[model samples]
Target: MKVNYTGFQASEVSPYLEVHQALKAADHRNGKPDVLAYTSVARMNPYQALLYRSFPDHGFAVAPLLKPFELRDLMLHKSRASSITLHLHWVNWVLAGEPDAQRAQTKVSGILGRIDRFKQLGGKLVWTAHNVYPHDAAHLEAELALQQGIADRSDVIHTMAASTTAALAEYTNVDAQKVLVAPHPHYRGAYEDVTSRAEARAVLGIDDDETVFLVFGALKEYKGLLRTLEAFDQLLDQDPSGRYRLLVAGGADDHPDVQEFISRGLLHDRVLMEPSKIPGSKAQYFLRAADAGLVTYTRSLNSGAALLYQSFGLPVLATDTPVLRETLPPHTALFLDANAAVDEYAAQLKALRALARSTTQTDVLDGIAHLDPSAVSSTFAQDLRSRLGLRQH
Candidate 1:
């Protein structure tokens, strides 16, 4: 079965890359989905010199989604072109408040009308719920309307987690039977170990023995950077000589909380922030250099970062939120109740740092082996085939 994925942006850092990579790998493996096409909403508009670049090969006919009329014509005649299997990566524009919401909704409604026609033409619709509902109140009504529109048009809906699926079902027009929870496909790059404890420290310009706690990703409000800083400060008071350094590797310029952390003397050189995106390969270096990975998301669904840490065997110290509890074992790394005392949180981090050195590194690496690319890609392919009414073999 051939498949076409429609998303806001297919090549950017979001989970759409996971969809592209998984589909590409599946095509290589089973040689089914005979064809895969990727259309990006951003690509439809002319923009240039964006700081980020797209992955050159996603094994799909990548294109810009043209105007509403063009989209209708394309979908209406997709059989002469390729099979239409719409995957809704995001519905932000269709849900309003974004730039040109009126125009975007007009275009999207035309496409939805075309999708209804596609079903009559024997096309399949698989809408992936990257977000169940927009969190902001301003977007609530528009989001619900878009949800109902997709529900009315789609043959099935796929969500990354059961929790997300359940949340999505609260919206009208979503048939509970049509939603399936598929875990986000795991991602693995070639395993590159830190050169050495000393060498890893040298690369990051830190002392070999300094205790490091790593925080990865663009600093977002609910990600709990402030809480993480507070915890780190508490840890420092216990042992000022502990030399606990927080190597913050990700874009942080947009977050005022980060600057607040710096200006308030909560962090000095101990808190390092990367103003740009880091290459995938060098990710492990930061992971390995740190004593443990830190995730203080006061609010989150699930973190690919936490999974990445788990895969590398780097123990995670995260708030005991629904998503965190699902992925991590209690005390294997450290899990603190969101309301836990700062001292309690500090103690957990302190213990992990001490125990981390003596813990078998191979154990951590071995655990992550389950998250290897081949396993995730295979699972993704089987699911895609099943959704497309094609036999995997």
Candidate 2:
């Protein structure tokens, strides 16, 4: 069976690749299906995945849409595979942040148009609902309407989180039978096999004495960076001479409030910003060197950041939220109320600082070992096989 994954190419470093790789390996081992991941011409250009075209496992099936209209004539004349399942990852930019009516209408229309075309071509459709988009109050109506349209046309609606599944059902008025809950792929990285804390610290340029609090990934509003900073301020008050420093490794995209807070001395030298994207290897080093990983996301269905932290054997201090709790073990993580006042934040911070010192000996390594890529691959292969009605050994 040839399964073509639509939206975003597989070569780039993304969570989607993790999923694709897992499924691919599982399918190969179990003899479940032959996967042909479809991607756009733009992604396959010499400037992109084409550079890696020699690598057969990269999964670069040329997508017809991105080609020039005249050039598409060539693709049309070629022998096309008729029996293929089209899995479209529901990806419309800005669907979750601030929903503009015009954009929402356009995005929905575009998605529906694509779905209609795939249907006409006799392709089985699976729309994975990664997000409903426009997470705020303003976009609620528009998002619901768009979701309804998607649900009506989609043969199967996929969701990684139960909360996301429920939202889809409620917004689309889709029957519970149509929604399929599946585990998103676990991260596979070189960081999993790392040795010592000293080596990890040396790689990231931090002293052995510093108690590092790591906040990884791009700064987003709901990620709770503001709350974490406020909490850090409180933490500092309790331990004025503390050696703890925050290492924030991510690309910054014009976060004015975060800058203002830094300038106002609220964060001071405690906040160390690496205002660039660190590649996969270095990211692992930073996490391993940290005393505790911080994730204060206010509203989240799931987090890849939390998984990365756990993969590197670093415990997390997250906000008291369902998503974080579900992803991490309660005993291994520290949680504080998302709406805590400054005083409350300070107390929690103080406690967290102390806890980090006392619990340094805790064996979190064993816990991280469970999120294995091979295990995740096997699980995903079995699920996809079951859904597609294919026999697997």
Candidate 3:
């Protein structure tokens, strides 16, 4: 089958790379619903090349998609099968043009119309609910309208966490029956030449005895980076002689709060900040250097960072959200209320630091065996074939 996946490129920060790689791996063994990637451009990003280099024999192929106007023309003139076999659109990235309200509305309306038309032409529409709404939504109502329209039109609405199904239905009024819950796959062998924990810590200038807590991934307003900083500061105050360090790694957003925090000179010495896009080869260095990963999101539907941390057999200190609670095992992760006081968060950090000192890597992996990438990929392939009425080869 010719599956056209939108909002996917080889070098995206989202789950597209992992999901596609897993599906490609699975399809090699169990050939069902043969898939090909659809991109707007021909060139692969450097990071994409790094990730795909090892899978040289992987059967996936990348082809260009019809341009916006060309897509409209095809929907009007061509048969559904000729136009495309299956359309799998992801996240709010596909719903572009947000600043100009009129333009955004027109684009959204056109896309929704195309979705309806695509279905009418016997093509399938799949929308993966990466978030309840766009994180950087400029035009709120227009974005929500587009989400609702997509939810209303999609043949299948995919969410990583089961808890997100009800939240998505509530937000977009999508039917519960239309939602398919599939857990995000683990990052087993995504990176190359990963650094050892000791080597990583040494290179980062962290001492062997220092307890490092990492806030990995893109630093955004909703991620509670400031709160994590506050809690870490309080922890330092409480234990003046403690060897605790904070590693805030990943891209920094243009949010005023984030910029303000950066300008305050808080990230120095013990607080190391790498405000850049971490390459796939260097991802393991960050993960290995830290004793535990922090997910202090003020709000979230699901956190891919948490899964990445867990996949490395690293313990996580996460804010208590319904989605995190549902997805992470209680024994492996330490959770606190989203609105917990700084002192309370400080205490939890102290506790996690002590726990991390004694916890073995194997202990962290014991409870999350189901998050294995192979299992997740098989499930994803099976679900797609089942929903699209395609036979398993």
* Top candidate, metric lDDT: 3
Q: lDDT per residue, candidate 1, 1-393, as tens digits? A: 766453443333333343334344443442333233323343311111010112112222233332322333334334332354545555554434555546555655665786677567665666766544543324455556666787777666766566664445557556767766555433334445546656767777878778788887666665666777788788888989887888887655545776675455333656765645666567766776777787766655556677666656677777675555655544455777767777887888898787677656566666555444545445544556566664435
The order of the candidates by TM-score, greatest first, is 3, 2, 1
Cα lDDT for residue 291, candidate 1:
74
Clashes of 1: 0
Which pairs clash in model 2?
95-133, 95-134, 96-133, 96-134
What TM-score does candidate 3 get on C-alpha atoms? 0.81
Off by over 4 Å in 2: 1-82, 94-100, 132-144, 161-164, 167-174, 188-196, 202-205, 258-267, 358-362, 390-393
TM-score of each: 0.72, 0.72, 0.81
Clashes of each: 0, 4, 0
Candidate 1 local lDDT, residue 27: 36
What is the C-alpha RMSD, rounded to one decimal, of candidate 3?
6.3
lDDT of 1: 0.57
The digit string of per-residue lDDT tens for model 2 on 258-304 reads 56534443336677767566665566567777887777666655566
Model 1, C-alpha of 22: deviation from truth (Å): 14
In model 2, what is the error at residue 204, expressed in angstroms? Answer: 4.5
Candidate no. 1 TM-score: 0.72
- Candidates in descending lDDT order: 3, 1, 2
